[model samples]
Target: MKNKRKILDWMLLIAWMILIFTMSNQPANISDSQSEGAIKVLLLIGIDANSIFGQLANFIVRKCAHFLEYMVLALLYINVAKHYFTKKVVIISTVAFVFTYACSDEIHQLFVQGREGAFRDVLIDTCGGVTLLLIRLGISSIKLLKLR
Candidate 1:
């Protein structure tokens, strides 16, 4: 049973890495423009229509998808890490490391011709991680309550 989980964990980790690589290498023009424009429109209608708000909205719109993607990856990785490692420390350390790796990946995009890395995007990405973590935690708590 233990060995099975270990294998699954490694497999999941590998798949996650492949996804990260694919996302990094994906063509940006189509997705990027869609994200930017959608956010702009949402901001224009949702916010006060100020330029700053528009820009902020655009930024969030542009990066939120990536953030959500990372969040899912992180959650899955956490689950896999928990399976392979007995200690809570090991699982948490892996999450932190994975999160840092995500930050670095985004930073790497900055050097790409069409990509610009921003701290705000990292923050948004972290929010995604936290959001998913909270959701999963909530689900776990609910399950525990039911079990009790």
Candidate 2:
């Protein structure tokens, strides 16, 4: 049963990595079309739908994707790492691994037509990982206080 749980965890991690890679492989135009649909929904809610605002909305959606993908990656990494390492080591290693992967992911995008690797995207991804870690720590602290 324990082995089964471990296997499931690794499988989930690999599946998520594959999903991220497949999305990164998409060309900019294909990616933009998905974001444009979300922008249209925002417009329906009465946000500005002018050309400039639409472009800005697309940009936000893209960055948010980066943020959310890494956030989930970090959470999964934490869960896996906790099974193998002490808490302090798990936190440090998870951050390092997630940040490194984010950098590599952006570099992968550089080869895709109409896509250029940007360091800013890596930073955004790192922010997402760090934010999740902070939230986890906060919740743990709250639980400790309640126990006392």
Candidate 3:
């Protein structure tokens, strides 16, 4: 049963990484269009996506994309790590994996036409990973408190 669960967790983690890679592999124009699609969704909610706000909308959408992808990546990695590692080891392993992959994803972007790798994006990605990890830890801590 444990083995099956671990296998599932790993499968999810790998699938997510592949999805991230696929998104990053898109040319800059395609990527921008995707972001624009997201903004159109926001427009439905009455968010003005024009003028200076247009630029801001694009910036927010792009950065949030970076943050969310890695956030989910961290959650999946942590799910797998918890099955195979002690608490201390899980933290170290998740951070290491998330940071390394974030760096690699940016490096991969460099090869894509009209796309440039940014150290800032890597940092944002790592921050997302850390954010999710901290949230997980907080929830765990609360569970422990409840058990006491």
Sort all candidates by lDDT, best to worst. Answer: 3, 2, 1
> Where does candidate 2 clash, by residue pair?
none
Q: Which prediction has more favorable TM-score, 1 or 2?
A: 2
TM-score of 1: 0.68
Candidate structures ordered by TM-score, highest first: 3, 2, 1
User: What is the number of backbone collisions in each predicted candidate, taken in the order shown?
Assistant: 0, 0, 0
**Residue 84 CA error for candidate 3 (Å)?**
1.7
Q: Largest TM-score belongs to which candidate?
A: 3
lDDT of 3 by residue, 1-148 (tens): 9899999999999999999999999999999999999888877888767554756788788999999999999999999989879999999888899899999999999999999999999899999999998998999899999999
Residue range with the least summed lDDT across 10 consecutive positions in model 3: 47-56
Question: 1-148 in candidate 1: lDDT tens per residue?
Answer: 8888778877887788787766665556755676766665767786543355655655556566767777777777776767647546654665586568678877777766677666776777667776777777788789999998
Pairs that collide, model 3: none
> Each model's TM-score, in the order given?
0.68, 0.91, 0.94
